[model samples]
Target: MGRVAGKKVFITGGAQGLGACFGHMLADEGAKVALTDINGEGAKKTAAAINEKHPGAAIAIAHDVTKKDQWESALGEAAEAMGGISVLINNAGIGTAGSIETESYENWRLTHEIDVDSIFIGTQLAMPYLKDNQPGSIINISSVAGLIADGMMLSYNSAKAAVWMMSKSIALHCARSGYDIRCNSVHPVFTRTPIVDPLIALGGGGEEGEKKLVRQIPLKRLGEPEDVGYCILYLASDESRFVTASEFKIDGGITAQ
Candidate 1:
């Protein structure tokens, strides 16, 4: 049951959806988790819920990932609270859709600010702590959109692709520097998270909308949070100690085509 028995994990966007799901899942497997979100109260609630199930294993912090100052403060708080930070989960990101011609420059910039740039900040700030705690892991939540191109998702496509490449660069750097901190990116497709709400709404919402969203997925279903969480658990655990600089796709075989 203790897949990550001694891990001290700091997760961004932990207030709800995939972040909350990963927090609960990792804590269940014996990790002490620090849940940070822009929604301070929501992060507390999620942390409280986890503590209820796995007493004293979770904490909450108010963090705006895009801000350098906030990242420093939050990381310090987490390191102190958890005794040290062994894992960093860059799970906070937004979904954006617009063709290059239709997309505003503002949306493009905002998408990169949140989805791509935050990872850059988090990884840089967390590197010292991660290096201090050797054999650590950094999990960046990229998306299938990052691996595949879509004409309609201009900014999203650009941001996610940046995340994908950045992860590899970080991984290679850590390896060359002789650090035991492994870095990898996860690419999930059409997961049933709030991030996909806009897409669903565009499809008209409800079950019909969800179904329309899954048509491209060979499995014909949306990914459950647990699907990605389990993968993160492995990456966060020592089991994947030798695994780094790679991409893990939880896309139900959509990329197989």
Candidate 2:
């Protein structure tokens, strides 16, 4: 049997990249998948592709993670489409890399809204459904930058660190309240996503940046979307039943040394 058989999963920013990869992976494990993204067209395309491979397995919703109303609507749509959400993956986030002095207030606010506030909104919105289900899982996608500071990612790193702490807080709250839900965060470094492409361009196409980055990592390669997806699935599934209030680092040893 598939690991996530009969589970219902709701993912934000699921139109492409790591979120899309998670949707595909969970659906493959027999979970009913609902993908939500700000780019409605991209969400549709991703859902269609997944459905083609696993017919009738997924649905797509247009959602902006920063808005509470949109999150409510997305959750309602997901419940209607997939029955009930057993897994909530708050994978929607954005990054801005620049010296602290060079970053605008607007950029900082936007980064926090998407990267940190999204987690708060998603978790708060999902609580009712998750509590009703009991024994559900919530996974927040953080970043290695959350654990270790980078040269010019001040806002991004700050937001991610908040996300990491938020995950711990939620987990402790759930445990203390005797709710059967678990919360965790994943910290990954320089994954191959469009989010990092612009940053790489700032240093010349990621080649030089990647080489410099690899020197700090034993794995010596950028992480794939699937790598994060699998880690998310593990936490979402029963395999990680005892794991909560913890940060799982998928940084290829970047944080190890």
Top lDDT model: 1
User: Number of clashes in every candidate structure?
Assistant: 0, 0
Q: Which ten residues in a row have the lowest lDDT in candidate 1?
A: 92-101
Clashing pairs in 2: none
lDDT of 2 by residue, 1-257 (tens): 78988888999999998999999999888888999999989999999999999999999999999999999999999998888888899998887877777989999899998998878888898999898776799999999989999779889889999999999999999999998899999998888888878756765664896676566778998889888878987988888989899999999998988
- TM-score of every candidate relative to the true structure: 0.98, 0.96
> What overall lDDT goes with each candidate model?
0.94, 0.89
Per TM-score, the best of the predicted structures is: 1
lDDT of 1: 0.94
Deviation of model 1 at 14, angstroms:
0.5
